[model samples]
Target: VDKDRDPVLGEFFTTESIETCADSIVRESIQNSVDARSGSRPVDVRFSVGCVTKSETGDLFLGLWEHVSVSDEEAGRLCAENGFRYVTVEDFGTTGLRGDPEDVMGDDGDEENEFYFFVRAEGKSPKTGQRGSWGIGKYTYLDVSMINTIFVLTARGGNGPVGGSGPLAIGMAVLKNHKLEGRAYMPDGYLCEVRPLTDGDDDEDAVLPFGPDSDMPEKISAAFNLQRADEPGLSVVVPYVPDELTYEELVRSVARNYGILIGWGDLEVTVVDETGDVATMDSDSILAVLGSLEDNSEREELIDELNLALWGVGLTPGDRTELGRHPLGKHPSWHTDGLMTEEQAKIIRDELAGGRSLAVRVPVPVTEKPDDVTRWSYLDVFFGSSEKKANKPHFYRQGLRISEIPSDTVSGLHALVIIDDEELAGFFGAAEGVSHVNVSSETKSFKGKYAYGANWLKFIKDAPAQILRLARSSEEDEDAGLAEEYFHIPEVEPEPEKEDEPETDPDDTGDIEDPVIPPIKRRVRPYTIAPLVGGGFSVTVNSEVPEGTVLTIDVAYDMPNGNPLKNWAPQDFRLDYMTVEVEGCNLTERSGNRITVASTGESLFKVSVRGFGSNRDLFVDVSLSEDS
Candidate 1:
């Protein structure tokens, strides 16, 4: 069928810069596979990136012209001449696209098939509780392919109609080749047409791709390296993969983005190149890596609850309900006292209670010390299985990440909350049918109906304060010593006895040895230098200084070889505008080259290296001690 797309389709996917185009392809395709999961089997997805000879690729196109005529001769010629290198994402343990090909429109939903919807329908999905509510995410494949085309091959893993049993379908979806030389003709935009299994297969001009019986044909299975005839699944072939994009990056992105799901036995993703199996990600290995990081015992219990929910472990009714509550143990309205009317906030609080997901707070990375408990971010809050991806907060629908919040919107160790409650899914400016991608750069303003009376921007602005309040409260209870020092006043010491202790010199005491005095250790450079954006490092000065101690901090560029990057050193790294936020302390002075801060009590020291145009923060959790 000829499906004309709006001219705007060209600019739709361009909204987000595709630096990680391969990553998007991997995520989007895998999300579809996972959503089409059948029975209790976890989706097993594989990405195979390899080159193909010109003739080899053209072999599948042998009878393509029989159905749709090509207008762009050069494009047609290039396909046959170069064949093409391709990235194929395939899934096992899924019921392959099923249904009668002729029944394109079905008033009765049962007669409609997955193939019909995917091939003919736009802005629709058949799966419930799935990530792809908007059909737009499917275009990711076409957008990444140089030819703007994709091939689908599938076999019914389950039962089909009498003649449809063991059905296998091969189809191609391609953007229409608009002609420029001939008399003007309206462009069809794009069209999807399946290869014919036989001439008399169906009454429609098109013939559905099906084998004689209930299993995939040997020839098709062998060409694509698909499951044996007995096994059932779907394989998607994306041709003309950009040379700059590599399979390794795709593997890494999957591991980082979906590692949590992998670790919890929810799914398995593997990537292969010409050499061999390039990389594989599973649940156990990811868990091992997380277990190796420095521990946070205070968050361990809550983390355990999250882990349990991920693995589908049996839970009590209370635990299930708790999943819908605020992960940091505070609602967004709690910080809206000054931002909104009490009645408005009360309405927001009541509406938020209808959600069915949790928010997670992940601490910014810091030098490990057992006693200190302070979060580096303003709120230290984010949503997901892990906090490492906080730099680019991704949006997910049903545990599958879809879009990333623009980096410009994420600043200064800020928190990212993934919204996934059934009640709240459609409220965040999601596209027509997709629940994952939110077109709005700013998410504070809710577009859903429940937000009619409430001010969403106010909620977004004030939610951080609420998260910070709860986080700070938890920190205080867990580390009372540090909190007490930062906020409590010290008692004055008693004066020495005036008469009895009249300034006696040590020399007057016979044979008295002078007490040994320790020499002061000066740290000219930071004890730890963390690299941030713009070739600068976040330098922490006097990380272990005592209460009331004055600290001098300098932000500079340093090389990994322990030498100053001389070329970069002369250029000023903007540390003058470094924003300082302290608990139980104050900044006495801040200038271009140096910063001086004094502690009132034991305090948590947080110095941001803004002088260098870097957005990262250095957390120096001070240790407290009373000198005798």
Candidate 2:
């Protein structure tokens, strides 16, 4: 058997496998194209597909097959002239074709080289300067498609060699499924050939035969007469398509697969329908569709629901204008009234600008679960700066995170919302009295009364006054002095004695007790000094008594010593001359000799004692004569 005649061999994959494999291929091809076109020239890529139809039950090919064509020489020249030297095609399957497995594994050896069709576009490689890597991607179409025929054609500016040497243009066709003796269906079918634009003497040569005979299915011939322009580039045609595929489906599939073809300015795709009317589809339309979002109330509702859900998790809801900034941002016309006020918006912007470290806690009612509460929660408020970079505010963005806490540690569910503006500085100091109330027991509620810093002095000063008033009020209400009544002493009862008591002598063998000594009293005298004739002297008191006591003093002085020399002397030091006072007590006197003072000194005067035990006339005057 001829090597070319051998049947293609491979495990044909199902349609699902083909789609999975195709997705990755398409992505990689587009990435390569994008990378090549990164700098210098912009690359416009377009993808288009044509229809396919199946003829028999065993024929597995279905729907439309993708076709990618590029301006080969033009793209190559663009790459060489510009810095871009790479052209890539994505969406080709791992097997290199968009069709069944049998199409890819035709005759393992090089006996009959299998060929595939692909678009050739130019781009710059980010890493290296290169265009078309060894034609590896070029054969991707043949590897997957069961179609055995391939067609390629090129036009040259200056013809010099076999491969179009000058301004190089080249075109070729392959018919792998052709029969040698009878009519044969070309591997790419009859549509694989490239027809000349201008009629020439070699028209017969241009119309190449697929096999030795012409009795093959006319469906392959139906693809003939595809004209090629004499422009400076290549044109390729693949004619045979499975009956299961439609032209529209094929165009869509190709557009989805090789997205670059649509943007290729020189490359254009036209699919003729059954009526012979050609329809053109732009790849940009598909791209626009993919990038666009559906505008509807359902979408708006979905966005609102998401916002509500995230709000429960502590994210604040933003206004419609702010929400419009996100890619998925949505706003409902009906809910516009619920937007934030200008002040609230400013606060949110400031908080977000602060940084992610800050957070604020807004108090919510205990009856309203955090998940259910909306208005009172911070989650309902929008935060963050209007600018993207300096977005979050410092206070709300940084410091200690805020949280809402229950009022009582055990029972009451009151919320203590604490917004920690700073992490290091605690919200409450030690001296700051903090209290909570358990409403369960009305009177036994928790109450703390303390002062911070110097304020404690005021609390201390008022405490005694308040306590005294409370004590007095309680006593008045009860008709009794509580403290005095509670502290009253009772009389002691005498013990009963035994009848058989022995008599004891006073000094026989008894314990002796120490004798008690009485306290001794010391006497102090006061003296007045006077001058003789015309001069005067000062008086001093000499006291032998100890400090801190009251004494009664008297003094009488004459001009000469030891005698009352004159009838009378000027009474300068009278009984009522000096005033007396005691420290730490309210006792004071002006006339009497009795006085109290904390210190003892010579300034104190002597006192006179009048009252005695038996005699009413017993008197002692602590007076000093002027002469002595």
Candidate 3:
């Protein structure tokens, strides 16, 4: 036997950025539905979980029972018992999986083939201007299934399959490679055809679905529990849903991840838990849900952060200033111009100064070169002064919360940046890593695709801080453009040691130096400090940190003429009066231009220190000081 088949995933896993399987699945579902939206309306998605009697759905599990037992004994046992747990997600206001069903040969010219991709493709995508582009989201569905099976029942909106327009139902399963009747069977199987392929002259691959709604058989509908009556949307029904995934987890994730969308009337979700309790989330009820949300995990206060963001978006004034297209300059900064009147600027500044909320419209121009033409994409920036120092910014791209990225935040301020434009969203989406939880330009997708990807990212990162800084200045001094030269954060490049002397001169006053000692591997990983609104900066750290490591933070004002460190003096600024904040760490020592800390871990290690007395684009260095 020639045994040839497409490479299939042998194991299922989730990325670290997404906290849990529940969060991953819910976010992916909403993202995909929004991408397939038929029109400019709120996309409706419902999550339902229930149990069914084995006798009602047992016939659908004939051959699957054996395959399930081979790989997942627990799922097989559940099937053997009377209780059969299931989860179904239905999305209205969507264009379901549309295209040719059997497009295995990738020769379709500019044709949208969500159907073929959903049916067969693995770890690939034909998506642009839409979320879930990396093609990793499809596997997330399979991960929550105990028996590695899910049923796809999509009523495509725009155009049905090339064959005809009708409802489609298919049972998709990806089990561990196994053998049946002394012959090896492939892991992927579809329950679309009328009858199971038996030992005969017929080819197994030819097993497929009926053409139209009239021709569709009862078995296909019965197997997947596809309860669509010519509605335009998609449905994913999973049988034997895992025990760990509960209604409470799913609903909470939905609220945290998409609460903003719900408040904006962009999305609505309904959930029916195993206990038969039903809850619906929409624009009216989302705020109530958010007001009562929990922190979800350790040491973080997400509710306060979320409520403040809602204030920035919902409570801020309707008047907006257009931040027009400005070239990507040498450094990260914002240019605010074209305000209708001076009063507009005054209002914006006064609100921020009073610790109130202010929202502004910001537009950015970008190009994917080899092509030079630029297009405009705008995003919303909301700012509210916080009672306590957050030292972080909340970012959302097309209604998805992008967290854990390195951001230079203004101390004592709550900031929210929302990107809605599809074209620009794609640019930032590529910059995200495999987890899709951060915005960074180091990834292959961003570096390979965008011309100024990294520059644009830094521009957005510094946009909020730059605006807040400029609001305190007059029109003529608004930009402070020249000041940016001194504010540049220089990458560490030690001046080359003048060690080897070509010829020794008696008159030479300077002595030749010894060879440079190699720097040791650090026990404490150091991240750059985020600049605050007024003068100082907040040190950023990842969650994976130990309890007793020392970190050295060195700071100096960048001088255009001489070395920042060598030229530092008491007149420039004093570190003596600095106000320092330490979380999961304790301050041990502070001197001129340097501060040391000993970490005591619980929450993510973070340190915010103010009172620089001067702001000139600081030259800061944070390094692992000791061996712990």
Leading candidate by lDDT: 3
Q: Candidate 1: which stretches are off by over 4 Å?
A: 4-8, 63-77, 80-83, 106-112, 127-129, 161-166, 180-207, 210-220, 228-230, 287-396, 406-421, 425-450, 453-465, 470-628
Worst 10 residues of 3 by lDDT: 1-10
Winner by lDDT between candidate 3 and candidate 1: 3
Question: For each candidate, what TM-score against the reference?
Answer: 0.56, 0.23, 0.69
Q: Residue 533 deviation, candidate 3, in Å? A: 8.9
| Per-residue lDDT of candidate 3, residues 1-628 (tens digit) | 1112233343225344577767878988888888788889899998987777777664566678887776666766766577777878889988887876544544323336777667756655678656667655777788778787887776766543564555776777887777777878777776766443333335435444544553333554564454566777888877777676778778888887887777778899988887879778897887666555554432233455556556655543355565545655333234334422466567766777677767877777767877766777877787766654435677888888887765555555667887878778888888775556876676556785665668778777666655654454333331223434435554554544344545667898887788556554334334534555555666766554677778877778776687878877866655544456555676778667777888776555766666554535787767754443
For each candidate, what is the lDDT? 0.47, 0.26, 0.67
RMSD of each: 15.5, 40.5, 12.5
- What C-alpha lDDT does candidate 3 achieve relative to the native structure? 0.67
lDDT value for candidate 1?
0.47
lDDT of 2 by residue, 1-628 (tens): 1112212122111111323333323333333343234233333332223333333211111211211112122222322221111111221111111111112223222211112123221111112111222223323333323332233333333323222211111222222443433544433322322343234444532322222122221222223332332332322333333333354444443344332334333123344555455444343343442233255542332233222222323434332222111111122121123233344444433443353211223221111122432221121122221211111111111111111111111000111112222211111111111110001111111113211212222222122122112222222222113222221111123444435545668778767656544444333223222211111112224443344434333323323344332322334232332212122212234343222222243344332111112211111222222211
Q: Determine which window of 10 residues in candidate 1 has minimal summed lDDT.
A: 360-369
